[model samples]
Target: VNRSATEIAEAIDYVGGILSVGAATDLSFVNVLVMRDSFDFAADLLAEIARTPVFEPAEIERQRQQVLSGIQVSLDDPAYLAGVVFGRLVYGLHPYGMPHNGTPASVRSVTRDDLRAFHEVHYVPNNTLLAIVGDIEAEPAFAAAERVFGDWTPRELPVSPNAELPAPTRRVVVVDKPGSAQTAIRVGHLGLARDSSDYLPFDVALKILGGEGGNRIGSVLRTERSLTYAASAEVVSRRFGGDFMAMADTRSDATAEALRLMVDEVARMQRERVSRRELENAQAYLAGSFPLTIEAPNAIAAQVLESLLYGLDLADLPTYPNRINAVTVDEIQRVTRAYLQPRQLSVVLVGEASAFVDDLVGVGFDDVEILSIDEIGPFLTRDDQVVSVDSFSPLLPLVP
Candidate 1:
């Protein structure tokens, strides 16, 4: 049991199969992909590991060290600092604000007893859902599943505490890294929940606003203006509620200029209806690319898992193309004005404090406050007092 993870991994590799273990906010799972002939062995191996993790003291220590190291590594990344701090600012004390791996102090405090208790409580069959996708037949798959997991006892599980969301305001939080050559910016605000009626329309709207290839932000900030090599916008959809985020990495000198362009593009989406050509292209791109996402067995399985997890109708998958295509210009414009609130945008920047602090103030940014990377913890612990400023030009001309 001391080398349980290693043993299981070796067994999986011996059979030329791949195994993945991961935890999400809601659940933890182990996924195995094996050749047809190795299916039975893989199934049994996964079952044994799932039902019988030993929680050895040595293994716990090893894993704890790994987690601590990972947290430190993430802290060193400006992009990670921006994202974690932004989530805290947006969600307040909600579970969404907590980092998935937890804080260093929290992780260090974890004991083997705590692990066992958590596993015993949450690892019941009634609370678990297994998804299988492969060339295997149903009869064999069912038999294999029954052989491995039929006896997992069901139990009543504890309910998670309901999180009360505090409304976030439009404020600028800067994480000052002494010698950072570039600035990483995260601009966003609270967005709709997963099951909102406007989900499809909003999806299309986001695609037009910042979907990979020729999106508005990419066109305006990167290709046309050349302020940065990469710029994109995304809606982080979650079960309760989510946020709309735009990210870009630009030279410290170009920080204010990039922020203005990004904000201007978002304002444009809400102020004016997107052109007919843009709408049609977004629809066509989504419809045409839908099939590619689920082209593989594992891909299909992933989609099925998402549908089940999010309480979506399985029919939604088959009807996805029609739903996207049905989004009219009116719907996009309507949701843009309703949901995309530019006035409530919270901006986060990770850059050199000396290089861009005055420049940020010069650009008329309101409520500018400085934070160290270490301060980007629970609820983004404020490290400094707010710097009062009246107004500065929101413009810095850039040339290609």
Candidate 2:
């Protein structure tokens, strides 16, 4: 607990172990990998880092600079900006809409006391799940975990604040990145949560729409029309909620056509029942991939941990392939019909807006809001300020 960051890093390196910490929308985790010979040291190290993070002011400032640098780099990336705007459109005021890395303003406001308070409230024995994988047997692994974490006290976690996710609405936002050659497009709306009973079948449906097994979105966009070099759609599931998104990068001139085709393909999945061949292909891919997910110790740990974290039955792990195989065409169609909101989609197109703004009307997207790259911050954070084409000075040509 008294060791410095450099000293901690050196210690872990001495044992040939890898240590990392990350936070996500739903959870935070500390992971360590080392040989069986270093198990005792690694376990203790893990507990020390998790339970006694120093959060020193100097270290926090260093990390803050690194994060701010990253945000600066992302600002110049059109694809990254498009994804951020898309999240805001889909999640609205929910925490999911906010960037995982705090904005420049938010990042600068964080202090040592804030970090300590957060860690004290969240880092508790009862709130944790320790996963040990590899050559260790159950009893010994449990003993090692208990030895390191046994003294840590538990506390009542505060109730998580709930905010209603905005319902899907058909709105088009164009992030006007002047002088850009390519347009990055994102389409779709809110999807089912991870724990929903409909998740499996709906996942199968999304795979057919734009995932590994069968990608009708890619087929129509990439293969048939050659509108873009690549295109795909996916459902991102989180603990409380999730979203469906179809993404593509196309020439600025082709933005409208690409966006139209993507939205049309999404609607088609809902209107039509997929062929039996497509259904089988998606199911086969999911079933085949199950084994690969748990082929190694780390992979096995991930699968087991995901099941536990999501409140899924651990016993169901063995039958994953069977369950995937059991999903039928009827099930796929049913989920698609129930969950797909094709008509109410949130769309974000980031690129040279003038290149394709006029053409968007031809594709039935008449109501559009265009914002310059510099204006994106306020648009995302503030309320009741509409930056429509008429009001945004840069796009004055389109307004007339």
Candidate 3:
């Protein structure tokens, strides 16, 4: 029997349970969590949803309209626009660059058969893993999984291998939102993979650089210079490469100054080792807060699921604090010098393009291009539109 989206949604809502669909570069997953007494009901609903979504033409068209509307709304948000362009710029043609919900054009072209073919290939017993954590005992949890899925035969999953990413090149992209009050800045380069040996040290270094209270960027830009209220830096990596992103939404007038200070802070990290006190604080922040983060069964299950997905040894989780504590100042310095490439950073700005284009060129950046929100695609094929840095002419001069 075909069920509407509202029917399926109402059934899950009746149990006061949660069901979410998530996608990543390597895989997509469904999650269901409910109270202990409602576990069996939740399991059955999840099984039904997973094994047999109606995928009716009307439902597909309804969802496609919703997704298209969402994409349109996201274009109005500066932070969202910046992130969308940043991902495309960082990942290029890789699958990681592909929008999880697909593009406006792509979504419109998806047929019911396309959805079925994708579901058939990806949603198989062999391709899935189940993790149940709550007040339930191990035996019952195991039995519940078997009862729900035991009859299913494992089949080979046909996943295409990801292509090799090209080397990153430094470029400055400006998405023009005229007369905007603030500029959303994203500056960083390609980062390491999740399984890199230097991940620990890089984490420590990132903490000192911009992890928390009064971090390097925040202290200098916000506290000292009063340029902005907040600033932060983080290295995010996936199965392939990631990007080290430093973001701040500063006043349009202070965009260039804030950018200069942020870049300077990164350069200083490579030149000078963090003091012992800074190192100790970063280690304490990571190690001391570790236990509190996993104080619940759901949190533990999530962590375990992440480990399994990434092929990380679950045994290493308990030793995380020890590894973090063992990081020395030298290791932070070495990792910073090796991985954090300040000169190779791609600067992305979403703001009044006329306000900062000349400023960026004045500050000596190359390959500065102005893009409209509609033009920020994975393949930005408008090389003829890129204004040469040496010959930049801003339409509007900076106010004040």
lDDT (CA) per prediction: 0.77, 0.83, 0.75
Q: Write the per-residue lDDT of candidate 3 for residues 1-400, one digit (tens) a residue.
A: 7456788678778878777765555555567767787888777766776767778888889888999999888878898878767776776666565556567777788899987876776677766766777777888777877887788676676545545564667777899998799999988777777777887788789889988522798889889999888899887876666778888899998888888888888888878988999999889889998998688765676677667765678898889999989999889889999987777777889999878777876566746888887677534434432211111110100000
**Top TM-score: which candidate number?**
2
CA RMSD of all predictions: 8.9, 8.6, 9.0
Clashing pairs in 1: none
Question: Model 2: clashing residue pairs?
Answer: none
Best by lDDT: 2
C-alpha-based local distance difference test score of model 2: 0.83
Question: lDDT by residue for model 2 over 323-343, one digit each (tens)?
Answer: 888988899889988988888
TM-score of 1: 0.90
Worst 10 residues of 1 by lDDT: 391-400
Better of 1 and 2 by TM-score: 2
- Quickly count the clashes in candidate 1: 0
Number of colliding residue pairs in each model: 0, 0, 0
Candidate 3: count the clashes: 0
Between 1 and 3, whose TM-score is larger?
A: 1
